[model samples]
Target: MPIIGMCIDLVAPSLPAIGQSFSVAASVAKSVISLYLLGFAFGNFLSGFLIDSYGRQKIIRLSLLGFIVASLMPIYLHSITWLLFARILQGLTIGAVSVTLRSICADVLPPERLTKLGPWFGTMWGIGPVIGPVIGGYLQVYFGWQAGFYFFAIITLIAFIVVFIVVPETHFNRHPLRIVSIKNNITEILKNHVFIGITALMGLSYALMILFNVSGPFLIQTTLHYSPIFFGHIALYLGVVFVLATFLGRYLLKAHTVEKIWLIAINVSLLVGIIAVIVSYFFKDSVILTTLITALMFISCGVVFPISLGKGLSLFRHIAGTATAVMYLVNISISSIVAYFAGFVDMTSLVPLAWMYLFLVFVIAILYWTVLRKS
Candidate 1:
């Protein structure tokens, strides 16, 4: 599921081609990135509602179906606007895939196993982005950008079949769907500070992540004039670092709980931020240095994602669908909005956005100690 979480990241390199096809400005191309995030936010919530109203398995089926179809069909549409429309649909389906997968993980994994399995989820997460761009870049360079979509479509088709055949119904409650219960259920979960704060943290963390993710291709390929394949390799390097960090985080968590791990994430994120800012100042023009800085920033994400998510949503097992969807939506929405605003900047300079990420974490840390220490 986390691998699928990466489908868009893989598509990042194709943004320039998309711009040329659409005849829009580079910043406008960035909105192709933003529109997807917006769709993700909306779809996350919609996915939850579907799960509540229908069932988890059914919703999963629907999302995968749409994902595969959208991937296959949208490439033929030439206008960037039309492509953006397709990407939006892709994001929507992917949201369902993420929300349902997380809800299931929250359901199936016991607290004991969650500690170990938590990081594996992050590990899988780290793995996805690594491959997404490498594959996307190859498709774009050798075949053209349209091949990227077809590639994802084929992957989705396979996943859809596997999911349908093996995934079980997880609702536990066999009762007919009740809209009021689903609505009230969301309200109940939101009332909890632990839930809101942790989820809010996910939002902010992802916002930082998307800023880097969305900007990477431009920063690497356009600014540095690296080949798409070369930038993809850089992404691969970053993913390798992230995968190792996630495993290390999981191993450490054998001796720690979610709170302790979150603190670790905070400390690492601070370092990552400081390093990123310094790198942006000194080596923003050097693709290698910038990649390393960005990769380091993502190292903390592997830790933050699982800890915050597992800790935040654990108490809401009864409303896992609504809770998980809401969480994913908010997380991506904040990131997307931040990234959209980032398009305002000259791509040549990455300091403002990097500093913004650093500041968000610094504030979150201070608040954690002062108010939400228990978090």
Candidate 2:
């Protein structure tokens, strides 16, 4: 999971250098990130049925092999187009790894155990984003942009070896490998209002995270005129907020219902968005204030995601792979769309980010209060 998280954001600090190397603008370079997410969404959509048909171990090994090959493309080929292809492949493998892992957890653990352990999953996941850019920054300074991909290939190779040695096949219940069967399974899960609501909330929560991931580099580096190292440090700090919040949530889950924790997170996020709007408009690009407020939002998101994900998967333990895939498909897809449109927003001002945050929070409220509550 930490490797998956690392793969996703490791290139953030290198976007500008990549653009200069390719003789393109930052906007075009950003596509490398977005295209990877697009592939991840597709992979998540398809991996559900495939993992259920085949086995987790087989698919994961093959995906990691594919990921390694793809990671080597741009480093050797030296083309932005090739880099985009590599990112897509990375996303595909990441989706397979993430969905399969989640399903395995659901397969091995009961609902109560799953709930207790979810935050630990989230905390480890949070650690990757915390250190990825910092690592990427030093790599970029020492070796170059291609070095990041080299790191990915090597680390993923080790992961492949580790999985081959230690991980066992966890899928006990298998569905038919028919297209009709897969479609019907997916349709049945979607029809559950509780599943839909929680998944939607989960996706939107992740979109908030992606929004920051995509925009943060440009905002901190270009608009705010900060050094890449400084931006990396800021990212590390904000990422720590998320890790700590997940730990706090681990304690909260002992006594509180998941919904209660989720609602509290929502309220805190709402307050942060409101404060961000006021500060971004009046103070107008106060770096310290904006960064800290956005960190608070990430903290809220850190709490919401694990709880929502754990509960949603618990709702469909029989089809854990499909359910988990659908959940991530929604998350990566929405996050990609939100990140793409965010390019049009003025990075000089925090208003756009603040507005986006508030809008997502509003949707989360409706999903919870109107849909999940009744269901």
Candidate 3:
């Protein structure tokens, strides 16, 4: 899960430097993120089937090894094309690792236990976003862009060793490799209105974060003339707000239903989004204002993400791996599309980001009213 955060946020601070190194435009460089997410989406599909067929341990171990190898590619390759390929490979492996781990949690932990621990899990994953940029920023400043990849390889290697030594095979009821069964499982999962709705909400929540990550570097660095290190500190602040909000969400869950918590958080998010738009229009260069508004939005996302993920996964315990994969597939695919298109948006001002945030929140509200709320 943290790997997912590291995959994006760790590389984000170096986007400008990467573009300069490749002699490409910022828009072209942003494809590194979009393409990696596309590969992640596809990886989910693959892992869903493979994990169900072969079991979690085998797939995750292989995926971790693949990620380590992929992390090394960008170090030796200088071309943007090769870098994109490496990112795609990294996404595929990390996506598989994420799905496998989620499936393992669903397999081993009862729903009540899973719900109880959701915030802690969220905190762990949230740590990546909190620290990735801080480390990447310094790496970009001192060791160059390649240093980030080197760091990735070293850390993942350690993780692979840990997993190989400690994690056991948890999936006892393995399905055979049958395409028809796979299709049926997917169809059944998709047909559950509540599951689908929660998953859609999860996708939207994740997309909001992705939108910021994809656009923030350029807005802060090029438009506001801030250094990557400063941008990293801002990201660290937002990440802390998100982590704290997750704990607040956990406390709220003791008294409120998941749907109620989601409603409250999202409505607050819509209000924050509106404020962001208004503020951006009036004070375009105010980095502090923009960061504050963005932090509020992150709070909304932090509250929604873990609860929704746990609720969605709980609905399909029998097909936990596939369900996890589908959830992330929808989640990352939305983000990938948003990230790709965000490159074309005017990054010279914060208004575009503000508008995008509001638009996404509106869509989320509508989805809740028509889909989740009714269901």
Candidate 4:
């Protein structure tokens, strides 16, 4: 799961450098992130059935190997086209691993236990965003953009070895590869309004993060003339806030129903979004104020993501792999589209980004009240 974050955040600080290296606009460089996410969505769609048919271990090992290989492609090729290609490959492989890992958790853990452990899981996953930019920032300043890809290769290699040696197969109830059965299962899951609503909420929450990842560097580094390392530290700070908020969410869940927690979180996010727009409008270049407000919004996401994901996955445990895949596929696909269009938005001020945040939260509210609450 951290691999997914690493794939995105590790290269984030280098986006400008990547653009300079290839003599392109920042928006063109951002295509790397958007295309990676498209590949992730495709991979999830494909891996779900393979995971259900062949089980977890085999797919995990193969995907890790592919990820290692793909991680090395951009280091040697030096072309943005090749970099995008490699990133797609990386996304594809890592996407598979993500679905497989989630399925393994669903296979071994009961729903209550999984929900209880959600904060810990989110913390571990949060590590990538926490460290990726901090490391990437220095690498960009000292070692150049290619260094991030080299780091990716090294870390994925370590992960590959660990999984091969330590992780055991968890999915035992292997379904046969039948087209009709796969279609039916997908149709059934999609037909569940609760699943659809929860996944939409998840997608919208995640898109907020993706929008920032897509636009933050240019806003902070390019617009405000901050150093990549400085931006990295900002990312680190936000990541910490996200991790801490997940624990806060865990504590709240113990005392409240999931519905109540979600409602509180969503409304809080809306309020934060309102604050962000006002602050950005008045103090357009105040990075501190922007980061502070963004952190508040992240607290909402941290609270919502684990609860939504656990609840959504629990609904179709008998087909955990497929459900996980469908859930991530929809969410990441939404995120990818957002990432792509985000590049076109002006970064001269934080107003556009703040507005985007507010609008997304508003939509999340609409989805919840109209769809999720009833379902």
Q: Mind giving the per-residue lDDT tens digits that candidate 2 earns over 205-234?
A: 877777777777787777888777777778
lDDT of 4 by residue, 23-136 (tens): 998889988889999888878878999999998999999998998899889888878889989989988999998888888898999988876766666777778888988999
Mark the 10 consecutive residues where model 1 has the least summed lDDT.
Answer: 110-119
Q: State how far residue 247 of model 2 sits from its true place (Å).
A: 1.2
List the candidate 2 regions with Cα displacement exceeding 4 Å. Answer: none
Q: What residue runs in model 1 are displaced by over 4 Å at the alpha carbon? A: 174-176, 350-353
Kindly report which residue pairs in candidate 2 clash with one another.
none
How many clashes does the backbone of model 4 have? 0
Q: Summarize candidate 3's per-residue lDDT along 64-101 as a digit string, tens digits.
A: 99999999998887788889999999989988988888
TM-score of 2: 0.96
| Ten-residue region with minimum lDDT total, candidate 3 | 113-122
User: What residue pairs clash in candidate 4, if any at all?
Assistant: none
| Candidate 3 structure, TM-score to reference | 0.98
